[model samples]
Target: MTGHAPRTRWTLRRRIVAVLILLLAAFAGTMGVASTLALRGSLVGQLDTRLVSASERAAHAPTRADFPGAVGSDAQPTEPTPSASAARPFSLRGPGQDVGTLNLDVTDGVVNAGYLDDNGDFQRLTDAQATTLAATPADGVPRTVAIDGLGSYRVIGATSTAGTLVVTGLPTAAATATVAKYVAVEVGVAVVGLALAGLAGTVLVRRELRPLNRVAATATRVAELPLDRGEVLLAERVPDEDTDPGTEVGQVGAALNQMLGHIEQALAARHESETQVRQFVADASHELRTPLASIRGYAELVRRLPEPVPDTAVHAMARVESETKRMTGLVEDMLLLARLDAGRDLDRVEVDLSSLAIDAVADAHAAGPDHLWRLELDGQGSDGDESDQPDDDGPSSGAGSAPTLALGDEARLRQVLANLLTNARIHTPPGTTVVVSVRATDDVVTFRVQDDGPGIPEPLRSRLFQRFTRGDASRNRAAGSSTGLGLAIVHAVVTAHGGTIEVDGTPGQTSFTVSLPAA
Candidate 1:
């Protein structure tokens, strides 16, 4: 057993939306990161400036017990010696650490101080001269140092006093947390803004694509058109009257509608040409049949004469005679169609189609003694009549009293049956069974002829009813028969009588059905 394949899927809409959202997200993310970095840098720079100013003021401050100017009746001043600890203001805090001071000793022309804390605290002096008071610096310059166990710091030497340095250290944790907080806020805003942007993008995309959707729908309806009808029924044309010609979709719709109009006109012309061809065939066939029939009859008469006809003459005459007969048959078939086209008035008598069918089948069986013939006449009722009066030429048995009656020409109808029977006899092999059936309802009558024979070849089915179209050309040549106008006449007559004929053929069986209006 074979399994069905999965259907193909399309994702144009989803892909479009996804791309738009991705672009918005990328833009938002870049902007948010840049903004956050700039804000954090500015905040940190301001904090660093404050730390430097506080350090400068602390470095220049006087000792805690300074006298300034003291007076006792007359101003008497005593020289004051600064305390060693106060002068240097250096306090070691283990691990080579110092508080309120920075060690500045030039060893190998390089100043080395272990570390300094944010509150003027330093530690981890590495040299003996690291704690000594050095000469006053000519210019104040802050140098960066790493405390013994802390992070990096900046220290500035004072110009007013020796060995005095203003120390300020920056902690990694505090600065890092401040920057992280700024980034977090920025990320949150970016996420929310990206979502809103995506929503807006979707709405904008749909609005922008609305006109295209209309164009697509119009195109789909046009594509579904039945071009064989020679007319386009696209009531909904793409509204291009007001659209800009330069727009992509507008141009497409305009071009398609233009093409459709051209196609419809071309189809109409083709249909007119075909109708003319069928008319010509029907007319020419009618005009040629009578003369051909006369020629064939005369030729046959000459061959049948016994007035010392030579053998060569007889053979030649026989050939001419057969050809004439074939040509005559072809002409008669065409003429029948042409007469129908010439609007030959129908007799319009209420004839029983079922009775006609039974007689036709019986006649076919009698003529083709080697073949089986079957008739199924459905004697169903028509309007206001339970019984149909059978004509003398019609069936006398099998068909019930109440048969399927139709409003038609009885002689032409019989001719139709004869053509069908002859066609089946000629096409099918000997001993093939032929089935003839008639069915009737209140409004319609149907006659069917079926034969069990090597059915019509597939290649010839399309043009089976066309004038001069023969299925087995070789057979026609061998039998010296068949002008190929029988089905064409059948089609024309049925159509003229406001009826329909159809053929279904396959290996071993072929069926022809004609449907007409019931009386």
Candidate 2:
């Protein structure tokens, strides 16, 4: 499996869930805490009321017999006093003291104390804990004590009989337990509530965004379409249900659908216009062929006749013949372009490029012998590991090596070469040197035509391969005549053969580079 990046920040669903949970938790926590605190305070207040009642009862209502060493109401004494004879085991005694409570009685500052246990037996308080209780004053207000071996106490002290003080205390275990239990329940409920809310938020957010997803999918399909050339048919659109303009998502969907409609209409109109132009070119080229042939034949016949025609008339007839042929060539070029535009397929075959260059260069030299011509080849990395093969058309015949080959129509490829050479020959000066280089790599072959002549003017250089573009001045000014379709035809043919061409130049040097896929 491939590694994927994890989202560091929240998504839309997560953001919604987080915000809603935050608000919910804040509100529920405030209420739960307020109620818990209120319950605690109310329970503790009741406990304090009971402690006050015990303190008051001990102050004025205890019988005189309720003193240390007094016997129980229904029986004789069961336990002896701690101050009794040494022979008896030490025991603590009190007068009618009750279990289930704590009792502290002080006479002449001498203390007697014990705490009631679960079995109703009195357990004596440790001396250190007893001393701590004694230091408290006989005030009605409650106090808390951390007694040894006894968890916590809420205590209050008050005066009893003559110079005697009484202390009453209660454990706070029940009240503490009640508050803790309530808090636990509240936290559990809040956690469950937040989880459910987060789940519901994610579901709702996904459902609501479905329409937008559909819109994006449509746009993505359109983006993947090939729209650069040929007829374009854009038919994808936002669905009807999503196109209602009332809601925000609906508004977006409606707008996108409308834009797609307009684009389809525009493309349809453009395709129609291009079709009409192609048909017109095909028809015009067809109509002109017969008349042009007749004009040429009549001019040639007039020249051959020995009727002693005037020299001026013969010269005029020759010009007419030449112009007619030029016009016929232009028409044929237009017809070929129209057919290509109409998607006519060319013949596909294997052609050796190095040999083709030699032939084209020879023809160019014959046509314009004043210009110096040369051929360049790729022998840069031939370490003898790559065996040489013989090629009938390869320029490297004398060098005992094969040449670069490409998959294309032989006739069209030759036409491309002829156009490029003719373009260079007619445009560059007589003494300018032209070089044709054929280079082969693993998957492509490049044919570069370089020249040392007055370069293309800067104003026309950018559109040098566009149809009808003419140079400000031709290098061979004495033979300056052009239809301006040579480079354009070169571009169209190269492109149809799955190739690319680029031109670059400065004063005295210019290069036209063409790249074709190797067979």
TM-score of each: 0.57, 0.62
Query: Which runs of model 2 end up more than 4 angstroms from their true locations?
Result: 1-11, 17-35, 38-46, 49-169, 177-204, 241-251, 276-339, 349-354, 361-407, 418-491, 498-519
CA lDDT scores, all candidates in order = 0.63, 0.76
lDDT of 1 at 440: 82
Residue lDDT tens for model 2, 1-519 = 998999698776678778988999999899999999999889889888987876666666444434546323331122212221111001123444334467666543345666777776776666676666766678778888778788778888887755466778777878889999999999999999988987887788778878888988998999999876679989899998888887778899999999998988888888889899899999999999999999999999998898898899899999889888888989988887888888889888888988788789878877877777766666533424322322233322234335789999888889899988888888898877787778888899998998989988899988888887777445442323778888888988998899999898899899999999999
- Worst 10-residue lDDT window, candidate 2: 83-92
Worst 10 residues of 1 by lDDT: 70-79
State the lDDT of candidate 1 residue by residue for 244-337, as single tens digits: 5777766777876787677667777876775676578776876777777787777778878979888898788788877777776666666666
Quote the RMSD, in angstroms, for model 2. Answer: 9.0
Global CA lDDT computed for model 2: 0.76
lDDT of 2 at 160: 71
Which regions of candidate 1 deviate over 4 angstroms?
1-18, 29-244, 261-265, 268-272, 300-322, 335-352, 379-420, 439-448, 455-469, 473-476, 479-481, 485-508, 512-519
